[model samples]
Target chain A: MSGHNVVAEAFAQTQYQVGGHGKRIVQVLKDVLNEVEGTVEGDMYGSGKLIADFEAKMAEYLGKESAVFFPSGTMAQQIALRIWCDELGLKKVAYHPLSHLEIHEEAGLRELHGIESVLLGEKDRLIQLEEILNLQEEIACLLLELPQREIGGQLPSFEDLQKISAHCREKGIRLHLDGARLFEILPYYQKTAQEVCALFDSVYVSFYKGIGGIAGAILAGSAEFTKQSKVWKRRHGGDLISLYPYILTADAYFDQRIPKMGQYYEQAQELAGLYNQCPRVTTWPEVPVSNMFHVHVELPKAELEPILAAVYAETGVGLTPYVREYDESTSSFEVGIGDRYAQVPKDALHTAFRLLHEKLQNL
Target chain B: MSGHNVVAEAFAQTQYQVGGHGKRIVQVLKDVLNEVEGTVEGDMYGSGKLIADFEAKMAEYLGKESAVFFPSGTMAQQIALRIWCDELGLKKVAYHPLSHLEIHEEAGLRELHGIESVLLGEKDRLIQLEEILNLQEEIACLLLELPQREIGGQLPSFEDLQKISAHCREKGIRLHLDGARLFEILPYYQKTAQEVCALFDSVYVSFYKGIGGIAGAILAGSAEFTKQSKVWKRRHGGDLISLYPYILTADAYFDQRIPKMGQYYEQAQELAGLYNQCPRVTTWPEVPVSNMFHVHVELPKAELEPILAAVYAETGVGLTPYVREYDESTSSFEVGIGDRYAQVPKDALHTAFRLLHEKLQNL
Candidate 1:
């Protein structure tokens, strides 16, 4: 097997590991099934209590006039920007070069909506307020992703975010928050969801990410914004005849996990500290700002794979699923702490890390 | 109350109705939850056994090399047309003016993909072969909806469909089947899905419609075509982390109902005949083509609403949920027969129709 496969096998074989509770469709929806009546009508084409009530709750939580549930965050964000651009009579927007829209969606913003995206900041860091001021393009909207996920879940201080919001408002540039992990960052900021959402003209949150729902998103903004999104949603085909499966799970998990963010954030910090103590192992951000961070290893993937597999087998603790090669001499993997982290025996976890440290020293 | 609300309340009160099985989300998913294991991983970002196996089954059934599950048929059809347009180097396509793409989707094809649609025929009928031959636009594709829905479920002869297919093939134009209700029309065509699919370059089928699935669609075609669609699916954010909810229900309901189309069609015809016998009442095409037909009542909505509501109240057999005003003098409502038809007591249904006939005559 290839090195990646070997690491994956080790991760899969172990009884104890890190990450969120499993994503089994059955397990994710088990609790939700009990709460719903079999005879109750499911929402049809976005009209029914199942979806409307959840949207209302999320809208109130985010302090927006209205919110619309969407099939995916990608569709919601693209539409959010498209709405802003259409309103401003400009088909241009700005976001970080590493934003999911810029790099991950196959340039859907450009190809599907004919909207041009202006890359805002350098790849490795968050978008600085100075960068927003220096933007050469006359952009209609600016999109900022909270806890910039591609950069190891790094987050800017809340004060900086406030300044950026003020500047964008003065410039007449609509600000949209790509807050896919919005719930995860709340503990670090020590702020309510409403406080953070208040910084932008529009916001999107993913239920499947840190909340551990099956899949869905909430695009919240003004009533007019949501009404327009409904039309664009139909255009994008995001309006499923029934979105209750997503809504039900999102409601269950959001309520279950939102209050536990502080716990997960502390667990992530403790876990990252264990890795940093090991030889040749380091974590981006040095300490985690939320429930996730990236791990960089000094050894190449080919050289490091067997050692990691051996550690998992001997210690019965899986550290990472796969180590990705950055170069022939370096590799990395991401770790996100959740309910699973609490399940690992503390003694076993420490022994696994000690073994991991010894193995790296030997290398 | 408004006329529409009165009719709606009457329909809601009746225990019997003429439509498919109820779309209660829990009921639709109850059986599926039992068959799946809680530990089995849900598909993540379109990866896992749950989605893959279902896609394989659909592709095999449709006689295609591959298929992909989509969140909605609107996204699938738009992406299918975009693919053909992209491959042919022409951003133009053709379909009936009342095609879902032309009317229902807020012109997503034109707005999102920059693709132009050439309307092929009059609003009141399916596209004729002669219209295909006389197309004024050099188009990349032609979309055909079996049992054309908007025109009251009318269909041309199978021989006519074959000729249109042959001509489109010869002209180098791709043919796509908007087979939203492909299974419903099979008894009339006397062809298996494969034989019907053999005539088209691509196909999109909805699970939520006649199948009574919660919501989902399948886009099937050549391996290359499906591969391209996957990319577009991601772009459109149709790739939910787990589509197993849809996939499982679709698999169950499709198997449960595929054998019942002939039954539903017969029920529809019988139901239409009763309406045709009533004064000033007519069925579109005056015959049922599939399991669905439009009922046109030659009275102003204001006049027809109370009469129909009274019939439902007196006989406890609801013929329709609402009547749509076509004009001040005429109103229409669609009826689709499914499991519910078998539930309505025969004696009550006859009495309901007799009452409906007497009321219409009194008008």
Candidate 2:
């Protein structure tokens, strides 16, 4: 299966698509209105009690003794790395090249936190233990994103992960997990959330991305660390009042969707198996270690647009968030298995791929 | 007027008593649910845009060219001062000691932007042109808060304001208006909102403080300045999506209450006149230049609490947000006027003050 075909298949199964259109405005309105009237005073100055409760609950759920919520994952990660640097008396964090904290946090770590990043792994490779071992010193923390979102949701092996965690502990380097997609990765790794979190000194999770909550991120750590983090949270203007709505939504989703992550993992396995039989598409990591997989399309960039449009028009689903040049102008696309993709039959993916292949072959 | 009398009079005018005796939870819930929504998208990202049109309209109403919305007046002023600093290559902003930006922005200008502030005028006096002239070097900007919330809602005379504006212009220092309570000040100033805004390069206003929207602020400026501000807005994570609810509420209040500020102003003057005649109570600035006025009551801390509690219990209205020890040993109280306070007749306040005086004298 080529990347083009992979994307075509994914587009044939968008969950958000309702009869080939957006969710109804009335539903959106109802949800939004509820948000406007929060459980307590949601203003910045007032609602201190609500914020305290939300933070406390977030801490308990994340398996940390304490936590503080931030407005964004960018701020949470940047602040975590900064804390690690200050604590370890070092200036650099070792991470993979595709880390979200590095690429998408808008240079905030460099500009705001004044910490440097050492990109340790090869551009296409995950941050291996070898890279961690090569650094003798000058590293404050080792950041690992389980099921890295950017390079297709691939996770390091459990044994490899244990080694990295142990190495960091031995070296007195903190292990910080950018667990934005940790919920999606849990079932694939056959681990409970608490078990995985035990490996890291601090973990940052986003409520908005996979949890379906409104915007917020929680940085969970030791009680001492989180207590100190309150000062920093206030300084950054992330100390919001009345976070009950976000917390309630996260709680509701935590029970319903978290248990279904295993299902997504199973569905992703089936989707990957369908692609494995095809020659044109090469799957990254051979198999997705999580609910998402990236397909390297062996097609020209010029053919991507029309094919994608045709797939959406014919199948009434748009799968990919973005398609771009991966190497030497060759196009690549990433796909993630969610509720919508699970609804589409595996045969539709096969059919979608065949149609995409026919279209690309003509080009 | 004695603080005890004020408290007693406050109780005598009660529509209902305190301890959940005044307002029913059902009524509170109904009003809140009907007026506000349950889940506001935390749309801090482009939430400003929903109010962008309203802000532009406000700018026009205030006789300005443009406006940008902020979650806080502190943020708005700090960002404005930062822009002035960046634009003029200056390191310091001049403001009064009690300026909210200097005291309340939590030292963000110094900690985050590395900019310094020079407090002008007497320690607690309205900013004067004489203080501006005494500044040793070029400064980035000058901040003036009309009816300064911290200092008993005081404002300078129009002639004095014009003089200060001219002085700043001659010195090439940008002038900014911290108009969080500007609406309340306008009727007392007997001038249009435009007249006040015209004296400054930037003006900031609030929604919840006086206009009584749930929570939001606006920063009005020139189009070019606001364009640069949009970039800053995203940098600060202030861009929110779908701010229609806050916008709609702000719009409703702007139309309904803005014109009524004059009435509040008239009531404030009457109350000030009544308080000035009292021996134990001191009214600052002689008369309030706005709907908000602060009364300094020379009462013992222990004596003040019960009377205030009684007032709130009997009247179902707040006489003060709190009782603070200006000096831990010396007892002092501050009174702020709100819609509730305005509804209480001057004689009620006089009677409350008489009761307070009698109680204090007996003590």
Candidate 3:
């Protein structure tokens, strides 16, 4: 038995652990690990000054007139759509069916916010102008997720986005960007943050995603919109005293990691190309335009698990699709790049495939 | 110049340096530092496993079968009420008129959740059976914040709470406890955590406030309740991967600090006695029953700021109500026992009063 088997077997004993995933609990950090020593005092309601400073920096970063920090992007986006619907007296906001607001958010937009979402576009494709034109006039806004995640990290073309933006503006409907993965989208578009943000009335960004913070989000928009969001933020218990820790982390990553996104983007293309060459693997949408892409593997769902587990057990390399079994004959995986291994070497990919193939053969 | 003036002036010029309160910013943590880490990585979604574990522990601690974590107690409580309203097929949640949900949340209960809040308590007291006897059938749940925060940290008598719980049971309405400051309420009730938690179907607790984690919340209830909450949490974007940091922090605090509440309760009583002796400061409800109480001072609003600033400047003490003017003639402030200053001595209380009195006399 290898190191991973020992851990996996141990984790298998717990109700929460599944198939060796969500295992390896992260260590609790105590003591000052960063360059700053935070005050140990508890003041979560946040002072007025801290709120003002966080909003200012967020606005400046996204090139919006103002911003409000939220505990979750779901709340921020839901509130944004709710406010949009209220402002226009429209009943719905339109978006791709697989958008996080739709599939993942447990119908919060409908249940919590009371704003109905018009699911446009094909079930698995990115939203397009054809979908928009077919929508009824009651839509107060159209929410567009850059580099849509659910459809294997697919993105709409820049021309299509511009056309959609102009269409919404012409029709007197608001355009909101669910820019949770905006950082990943920027390199693909070769656009400045301001240029992309300028395309929407409001943009929602997460600090913890690519930026690597503990937990936080910024909802950037016009000063008026942000002020209204601040009220909602407080109401939602999103406000905290001395958001300085999250702010500091965001600042650190903004300077150190953000500039390197273009390199990561370039590397993603290289990685996708390597996976595409594997006989049993089919990469989504051909080329990688963003830092994320999904791969579909034609492998027996039951057979693939043990072999892949053995491979990870032998080598410290973990392959994703991390067991997203689509059916008995098919399974898929999504890859996210961070400050970890990027542009996986061809030999490693081959070795991984060999291990996977042998495992299926044994089965 | 006084030390505080010089430090405050320096901070003003330096844009208020981070990590200056408890210890110096060091590359390596020198002391134990109470196990709070200086930095966090990954988005809370992928990196917040600590949050999930914390929620589970919170559920166990509250004697609930399951739990979900949130960014803010305000959001957690609001969403809980909203969930109750939807599940029960009603549209109202009864709470105190001065509930944090109403005043502090910026009408979010109304604006975001679309669930109307029926204020049940008197303007200055906890809700009794009389307040809710007239409640219409539309009421879905009643929100009870043990030791209600806004009204000078007053609590309903234990028997009163039992009656209220019975009333909700009889009416077939759910009971949700906004137990944000619940740690302070336990000693007064002389009840164990399980005993108090038994009265409500759901409870919300804060990590940063009582537990001293960076930021997080736990909403606990039945297994079914938590399963539904997970969907609601994901919709609200609260689901994160590695919450180990918060979970560890909360766990460590629960182990090391929770057992010490009895001491804090005693010290709080001592501080209340000291404040009662101060002629210039009149405490609300005569004395504090728990770790928190309010002080009313007959001071001009503008004059109070400088005096409080001077006190904090002279000694690193943060006193609040520092100036909330009730009318033109009277002002009020709230005091809570924190880790840094567990108890405010009688002499220290006199010193703060004497300094304020001198400043007011001069004015």
User: Top model by TM-score, which number?
Assistant: 1
lDDT, candidate 3, B1-363, per-residue tens: 233443244323321121111211221122323444334332345334445556666777788888876656776787788778889998888888888887777887787667887878687776776676667646899998877778778887888788888888998899999887787678778887779989999998876554555556788888887777667667655564344444554566566667666666676676666556655567765667666777776765555556666755554344552357666877676666655344444455556556655655565
Predicted candidate 1 versus true structure: per-residue lDDT over B1-363, tens digit per residue: 353488889988997886777646576786677776777777877777878899999999999999999999999999999999999999999989889998899989999999998888898777887888888779999999987898788888888888989998899999999999898898878889999999999999999778988899999999999999999998898877788888888998899999998899889899999989999999986888899999898899888888988998998888888888977899998888888999988899999989988888886
Off by over 4 Å in 2: A1-29, A32-47, A88-91, A240-256, A271-279, A282-286, A325-328, A333-339, A342-354, B1-66, B237-256, B270-279, B312-318, B328-354, B357-363
C-alpha lDDT (0 to 100) for residue A253 of candidate 3? 61
DockQ of 2: 0.22
lDDT of each: 0.89, 0.66, 0.67
Give the DockQ of candidate 3: 0.34
Docking band of candidate 1: medium
Return the TM-score for each candidate structure: 0.98, 0.83, 0.83
- Write model 3 residue lDDT over A262-318, tens digit each, in one string: 776776676677667666777775787877778777886555566556665554456
Candidate 1: tens digits of C-alpha lDDT, residues A1-363: 353499999888998987776545476786688777787668879888888999999999999999999989999999999999999999999988899998889888888988998887788788887888777779999999988988899998998899989988998999999999999999999999999999999999999878988889999999999999999999998998888888888999899999889999999999999999998888987889999998989998888889989999998899888888867888988888878999999999999999999989986
lDDT tens per residue, model 2, A1-363 = 445554445544553331111221223334434544333444244235555677777777778888876656765777788778888788798888888766655555675456788887776877777878788657898889987777777788888888888888988989999998888888777887788888899999876555555455788999777766655555444443223334444555555567767777777777666555554567775777777787776766555656766766665556464566776546777666655665566566666666766666666
lDDT tens digits by residue: candidate 2, B89-142: 987887888876566556767755678888887655676656666778668898
Report the poorest 10 consecutive residues by lDDT, candidate 3 chain B. Answer: B15-24
The two-chain DockQ for each candidate, comma-separated, is 0.75, 0.22, 0.34
